[model samples]
Target: MSLVVTPLELPERWDEPGPRGDAFRAFHAHAERSNAMRFGPDVVARSPEERLASLQPSLAEACRAFVAHRDGQLVGALKVYTPLLESTDVAEIVISAEPDLPDAEVLDLVEELTTHGEQVAAGLGRGDFRGGSLAAASGAVTAATGFGGVDPDHPEVAPLVARGYVLEQVYRISMVDLAALPDLDERLAAARAGAPGYDVVAWAGETPAPHRAGMCRLKEQMAADAPGGGVLFEPEVWDDARLADFEASAASGGRTIRTVAAVEGATGELVGFTSAFVGTSTVVNQQDTVVAGAHRGHGLGALMKLANLAELREHHPNHTRVVTWNAEENRPMLAVNEATGFVTVVHDGVWKRRSVS
Candidate 1:
């Protein structure tokens, strides 16, 4: 069958629901299924409306998405995004294929998509870009630099290596079963004894006006504090405007973000925090957890994580598991996760290439 490649016509059918837009829904379903394979379903969990919102242009990233069709069926998709935050010289691309596609056809489609991605990157004043493709293992997404070389194990790694990409980072994927979660009472108590000056604060949805300023600062701390593992990164700066934009986007996508934070009783400042997101999906996704440097050794990180997880479980008892990813070098956070019942399920690699376009 001949394959046709074109820009995804979002406005033409994205809003059509149910019987009215079978084609649009078909593409969306394909994307969701493909994402479930690349990242765990819980990690990429999103309704079609939420997924659609993600594909739309954002102030932080302008995306150009494309789909490949064969025999009137959507077989593959490629999304290229140029970050407005940092890495102006770089772009990020995600490519996926229908599970049943022949290897040759998948390669052809990906090659075409990569070519298009490079064009977009060039238009954005970037000399090179990165692309992430599903590797051979489950829950393993491999990234390549310069639109090419990536994790050695991914099926597409060879092509990328030939194109000058090389492995840069490995991130371990971990999961915790909520049913078997051990008692955190002992840990929480010990942590609280040492951090008696700090109290836990819990919230659902947007932060309260009183805590908004502190939450913003804590988010920035999370970015600055997390281990980068050698990829180009710019610390994401956050403020009321950005946080509101984030909440609005999450709402539009049918998501609820729940957070737990440790506040300094004396200053009313958020010193550490953890976030978990649940939407229409059964699996909860653990996002950022960070403690300000000044509050590090006091066990506030573990306290914040434990408090949030308990609060989350109480509200969403049906959520079977929680999933999170950590860079291999982030031993402290990994230790906290391991102690809390998280087990490594898969490993993902991030790769980089330069001036390949």
Candidate 2:
């Protein structure tokens, strides 16, 4: 059967009862199945309602989605996120298909999705493209960063390689069971004591007024300081407006934001911070954790993380596990995570296509 590709008509409310709502739900279900096949059975995809709630757009980025059908059955999807910040020249695209399809069918679906995604991006004046996917670590195709590799034979990976996308970096997806860590309190105490010059502070929901500017600065620094390997990303620009938009968007999506920060005791400035998203599901996502360049070596990263995990426990007690991704080359952050009970579950390959111009 011939494949039909079309732009997904996003609903004003994802729950509106109609053909659009049905398509929305089916697309998410297909996404979940694709993730399970690409990663492993242990990996969990976001629930449809949870995914819909979090589909937020902001001044910094605009999001779009497309669905593929064959014989009126939803078979594949493509999403594009165009950055409106300093990296406006590039956009990120994600494409997925229903699992267990024949190899030929899968390739055709992926190829069409890629061609469509590029056309949409180019129309928006985006020349560079970024994407990520999970792949088994069994092939000779190594990331340029020299830290991780992915099987080129993997169904999800081969199409990208064939289309000239280069593997830039590999991210290790780690998970930690909240209930399994019996010594969290002790670890928090040690991390706090080690950072004598810094004090820990935390909050649930929106950023407090006094810390908004400082948080913005830390966010900007996070984009600049985090290890990107060969991926091209200009530092993000965050201001009061952007922060407010972020909080509102998260709230609209039914996600509660929990944050912990390290304050320099002498200056009372927020030099480092970490945040987690507690959504409608049981999983807690460990978001950005960064310490300013001058504030490194004080164990601030670990300190903030431990404090945030404690906050998650106290406020959102029903969480099953904390999940985070880090560049495989980032040994310091990985060390902190492993010591705190996180184990590597899978690896994600970050791929990029240089400007087509």
Candidate 3:
């Protein structure tokens, strides 16, 4: 059967009630289970509404989704999003085929969706694409050499690799139990003592003006500072307006972000910081954590993380656990997380495609 792909009518069908809505929900559910089959049970597919929430346009990116059907039955999907924070010539794309689709057909669907994603990005005046990706959890390839040979068994992996994409990083999803934490006070005390001449402070909802400037500085440095795993993150262009938009959009999505920042007592400049955000949902996401280059090696990373966790314990008391993802090669940051009782729970692949012209 020949498959047809077109822009999905999200605004109309998203909140629509009835059989059509049921079909819409069923379409995504099938795609999710299908993708999970490739990765494993750890995929933990997000609910349709949660996926919609992720698609909400941000200050730096715009999103679009498409449905692929053959004879009117959903067969696959394409998600295209471009990031202004990254280079103007780059976009992120994800394509999925129904789990039951034959391997050969999966390749065709991926190629078609990729071409569609490229067209979408080109329409935005962008070219190259840098998409975060996933693959089967084992030894299909090594990190430094890009994607190696593909097992004919896993044809779904070929499209991106065949399109000039490379595996830049491996991120492992990790979680820590708040209820079984080793000891809050002892760790917090040690963190404070380890980093002298700095004070740790916490915030919720919005960043206050005094700390806003410093916090923005650390945030702006985020992409460049972290280990890129051979991929350029393309430093985000940050400003007061951009930060405001981020906080507002997040709150509108039912998320509440809590942050803990370490301030230099003498200069009052933010030296390091960590943030955790939770929605009406149970899981609390441990967000960006960074220490100014000048402030590293003082155990501040641990300090801010512990301080933030302590704050969450008080505020989001009912939250069961905290989750985060870190590059597999980032030993320092990963060390801090593990020291705080975080353990690797899942693995993911990060891939990117460069422009030919």
Candidate 4:
């Protein structure tokens, strides 16, 4: 199979009022439709008007869009960032061909893009170009691209592994569902029967002023417990402004954040907490759920999860299904998810690469 790859200037291809601009939008729509499991329906549901409004600013700044054509037909496309402030050089490549595309043709397309990426990085005085979600079928492309492995859990890791990339870091993705969640009242009653002194309240995002200090401490403790966790981030990490940004982002995407906390009646210390985000797609992305070490074995985790699901159902009545991802090794958190009615629908591994030369 023969293919032609071309570099597209963002302004020329994606700017307002251009033929190439329309093509770019159509390309993304096709990609999202073909890869629904990866990109999700929210992206597929984006109208052309919405796409233009949402992507115009980013295109003006760091967009590098490319398209692959075979015999005058568009076959594949990629989008890469051009060294922004928050990112050195992050890139994502999407292929629209049928899954049956030959390995050789795919590798050829990857090599073409990698060559362009190297040129772009060098011109910007950067040493590496990072790509995410390389997929299991793109092993040859990863090897040909010369990107070293950074993390195995990243979506791109499996392909990198097939090409000899080493693991750098591993992070866990945890999740829960709302539809099958246990009855919160039943769990609360059971907890009350066992430990009548503790007060369990659903966090309505209106965390009480008195419990703020305890919540801060719990946040710090959870961060500290992160496996291979790095230097402690400042309080600003969980400050009101940052939390508000999170809330706003979720709201914009038609998702709701629910948290439930268990507090000690005597000292008002926060002992356990669980948080869930209900997305427009009905997938409940479990953000963080933890019980402080001092409060383990009290069934507080289940109580919080149950409460969050109940509140989510109240707010978002249209949601029918939810999904979450967790590391295969998180026994405690996995136990809570299992008890609360979340089952694994898909298992994905993440991969990363750094300092590709």
Indicate whether candidate 1 or candidate 4 has the larger TM-score.
1
- The predicted structure with the larger lDDT, 3 or 4, is 3
Question: Which tens-of-lDDT digit does each residue in 68-166 have in candidate 2?
Answer: 999988888999999887788887888888887887787787777887888899999998988766743434888888888998876667888899999
Q: How many residue pairs clash in each candidate?
A: 7, 0, 0, 9
Candidates arranged by lDDT, highest first: 2, 3, 1, 4
For candidate 2, report its TM-score: 0.94
| C-alpha lDDT of all candidate models, in order | 0.73, 0.82, 0.74, 0.53
lDDT of 3 by residue, 7-115 (tens): 7555443457876566567666776677467544433444566555666788877778788888887878888877766666767787777888887887888777888
Give the Cα error of residue 266 in candidate 2, in Å: 1.0
lDDT tens readout by residue for model 4, 196-304: 5577777555456776666766766665563321111222224554444444544442345677788887977888776665544555556666788988777777667
TM-score of each: 0.87, 0.94, 0.85, 0.63
Candidate 2 overall lDDT versus native: 0.82
State residue 240's C-alpha deviation in candidate 3, in Å.
Answer: 0.8
Model 4 lDDT, residue 142, Cα = 30
**Worst window of 10 by summed lDDT in candidate 2:** 38-47
